[model samples]
Target chain A: MNYEAIVIGSSAGGLSALKSIIYNLPGNFSTPIIITQHVSSLSESYMAVFLNQLSQLVIKEADAGEKIKPGHVYIAPPNFHLLIEEDFTLNLTVDEKVNYSRPSIDILFETAALAFKRKLIGIILTGANNDGSNGIKQIKHFGGHTIAQLPASAEVPIMPQSAIDTGCVDKILSLEEITGYIISICH
Target chain B: MHLPDQLNNIQNIELTHFFELIFNVYGYDFRNYNKAHVKRRILNRINNLGLKSISELQHKVLHEEGFFDLILRDLSINVTEMYREPGFYKSLRNEIIPILRTYPYIKVWHAGCATGEEVYSFAILLQEEGLYDRSQIYATDFNPIVLETAKKAIYPVSKIKEYTLNYQKSGGKNSFSDYYVARYESVIFNQSLKKNIVFAEHNLVTDGVFAEVNLIICRNVLIYFNKELQNKVTGLFTESLIKGGYLGLGSKENLMFTDVFDQYQVVDAKEKIYKKTIFSSK
Candidate 1:
């Protein structure tokens, strides 16, 4: 099968960036997308509501043990780490933060790597920290396609730079191009 | 100590052995857990301890004093908060509360209670609903360290804001601040909330039925286990509950694939609350 899932991670300055890509996706873009964006725990479930208003696809905060479905976006809520279980269901953990970030992009990407294996696309976007670098590496190790946002195009370059440094990034593209590229590869 | 930049397939063997070591030594059976989660947690411990490989970490785990606790904590994965998934709590207050009121005395078992945030949150809800006097809540976790913290019921004042929002969303009728007293950097919840609570050690994996509770709340805990363990824990939950008693799982958890799938009737499917039927479907 082709790519079954796409996992994206962002940190500081992630909200607007995520909106730009998610809102721009074509109506038929149905591959399941999972996102982990660093935010204060105080944000609660507001991020899901905010993103749902922008994207045409069904968007909601991921809950533990929810079955993963195509044509929807699952956002990791603050103060929790999201993982993909063996059964392709979403799992949430209140486990200690990774890279000082709960809902760490790395955790979601790594688990999705195992769950989706070769049929996965891992994207690391703008974030001030190196949270998602190792995750994308894991994705690449599992033979999944890995993409990193071009550092110059990011609000914060450190995160993408770290992923690029791993030498595992298969492509580096602008958010606009990334959106178009995602639509291009699947169907 | 020669660590590669990337994990090779051969590393899977070492990791598997590490799980075996943990089970043999500590009796925490994580052999069949989701591999990605297991690997990540193992990698975390390896990095944290400045160890180079899983074998070395396993050696340390077997030989060192108190080293296993760190691994146990990592394995426990206790990231939880008050009034998580506000909708579920909302359903409990609006719908389950009335059913619970039918019982002269209520017993609730918060299996894998973590830091007792939910238990405390439920206590606050019970107090507000005037049901605290008639309730006995057993908050248990295999990780006694967290259980001790749960017993303390003190939380960083920083988290209270989000929790306050959750409380309001879950249909709190009173001021959220009334439940907690800000003291120093932490907030101390009212002692009365613990009046009906029993905090203790209970491992769902290895332990048996503890009580015939009216409700068993085991949210976000089952997802860590593999299918076999998940079913096993569900069986424990099924047996521990009285007939027609309730079982409230985490929002994403469902009875769809479990052995007890047909044994309970859905009370609120969205909220993952189920009531036991008279006959156990075996």
Candidate 2:
């Protein structure tokens, strides 16, 4: 399916993995990127600021009712679910926590799949839980592309392994290869 | 397996089972919660359901519709009271109310607000302070069904006597009974208390910031999370709060070990209240 957006979900080793992929994306990369990194309720927005320095892309915490833009990266603020809207805007909800996570990768991926349908690419990365598996299935069911970081290469493999075990993933690439794959698909 | 082995196995499988059950049926996440708490709650749920094993509880939940609802109530910690602790509310009135009065409008996030009693108590306090008209309270919880109960604003009338004592201790100016009507055995809180409250479902473990607010009150909820999850949640509140915004935590909660420790100074240490300090963006 042709994709205009990428939704990524990770935990545990997500920071380094995400940094690797974001760092590789060119400053001119035009597809929108959304991330749901597992975070605690007491966390600060330092992750956004930290990621902003790693890439030229605009990085900010997703705010309720904010618009999604290309060349920008939106990180889920701590303790709230972040979903994409059909209008290409961000919708923040205090809806039920998924997978014991507010910005649950599953919640983001599932909602994004419904919103973007086949025009989306869902990636499940390093983490210790099966948070993203069902979400990736939804992405595949919606006719979007689905990928997981190869468990052997992921810092924490449970999340990736869970996604792959769902039998819906189209590819399982390392963090370094994910950037190229995303670029190719979006282009 | 022996009891220890059985408990450990349940601990390991409980989260996975809970996660699957929530996603496939309820769409909620209990996967990353502190394992100890999850196990305890799951055990309590099993006992409540009169099941012999975790697998039995799981089977019942997966096969029996609406069983998830019962399990959710058992899993969720809803032990709360109006004017909880009294002292914290008193401190809020003494230290925070005056400051809030200066703003043209006030926004407060009462995170993990269970059953709505505490939210209603705060609303009554705000009304007594004459700040209700200018304030908006966003009462959020992970349990939407509980939130619906909160929105209903009803409680057992038997609890009102204790709530009255708490209200008085919390520096309430009028009789607590003024805010609710006693009907039969239940107390129906004044509908006006919810006028400015917006109830929504939010998971502190995975959700993002709600809004730029002057005050955030998340009590008792953080104790359910592990240190990593706690730190992440605190960071979200710190970022969502405006400069000089106030953060109030449960009495047992603290920021000493978090990355944001130096970013906030305790305002009323005894009350677990803090005021954010200006810091350079990371």
Candidate 3:
């Protein structure tokens, strides 16, 4: 399937995992990547800038109403639930924290699943919570692809393990395998 | 389209029809809200009430007496806290209050004021800065139930700790404890804070411009709106403000992405404070 968008979730121990995953994509990669990494509500805009410097993907914090474009990376701003509207534009919300986190993986994954349907891919990486587990299921329910990082290979295995527990996970690939699979399916 | 996709389309249609049923019967419009947000909230109501589907929910909403109020409350989640973003208020006290001092009389509208926590927060800040006497504050929310609750200024005592920390961080001049009397499970704020404040029902979706003011403190409210509604609300804010007036949005809310982007200059970038440009090319 030619996937148009990718939604990724990570929490504790997410930094290196995100870096390795981004490192695996080619310089000419051309699919939109949306990510939610758990950080303090006071976290700054530096994550996007730092990620952009290290990776080929053009990364920036998602601004409200910005059109979702291929080949770009959009990171959810701290303390806001980044939603995908029907028109494929971004909408940020200060709604109550879901799964005890704003920019909750479930909110992003579930909304993206509805918006992108079978054309979306959801990946769950190292984290401490089960925020993305239900989200990945929504993607799968909509006939989309779902992947969880191999628990043993993850810095924190609990998150991906939780996604695996859902039984909706399509694959539990190693970081390298995940990257290869993403490139193979996208664009 | 595939079967499930077609089914999804059907559900969407049902949801839109539900919105219209609501507007027609109640005269409260929600058709302009962000659809995904509306869909999720409606689905939550469906699941919570153990209803079979959105259409089922719609039937109950139309036929059952007072059922629409329950659904209305569900749609507008009054999930907010006092001094929610401390830094925004700190910036207001340090940067914006000085400018407001210039006016002999200042009018501030707390648009989408939610449950009025931030309205009281602003009042406290103004009182601390000694600007309360000359200020007229209008606090509004579409949810009338929350509006009444706001007028009482009572909050769960459980939230006091967080509000106290936020108060301190927001450069509060006095002990946070002094502002409210904590009795049992709730804390009642000082009644004097409500003196210059008027709490009313103002729906950002359908309400017209009601006040021409020096500042509009609407934070974190516009995120619920789609691109079109966001622009419309921003335009209302523009028309509501006097020339060169101030608008403070939530930290994550961007004034730059809207069609009205050029109409305002950033007054405090970090705090998301914008000043209406005196002369607009548009």
Interface RMSD, per-candidate values to 1 decimal: 4.1, 15.3, 1.6
Off by over 4 Å in 3: B280-282
lDDT of 1 at B275: 88
Alpha-carbon lDDT of model 3: 0.89
Q: lDDT score, residue B25, model 1? A: 76
- Return the top candidate by lDDT: 3
In model 1 chain A, where is the ten-residue run with the lowest total lDDT? A85-94
DockQ (0 to 1) for model 1: 0.41
> Each model's fnat?
0.51, 0.00, 0.60
Give the Å error, residue A1, model 3: 1.3
DockQ values of all predictions: 0.41, 0.01, 0.62
- List model 2 lDDT by residue over A66-183, tens digit each: 6788888999987666776545766554445678886788878876875677788999999999998988997887778999999999999999999999999999898888999888
Per residue, candidate 1 scores C-alpha lDDT tens digits across B61-173 of 88999989988888885778899888888898988899899999999999999888999989999999999999999999989899989999899999998899899999998
How do these models rank on DockQ, best leading? 3, 1, 2
Ten residues in sequence with the least summed lDDT for candidate 3 chain B: B1-10
Clashes of 1: 1
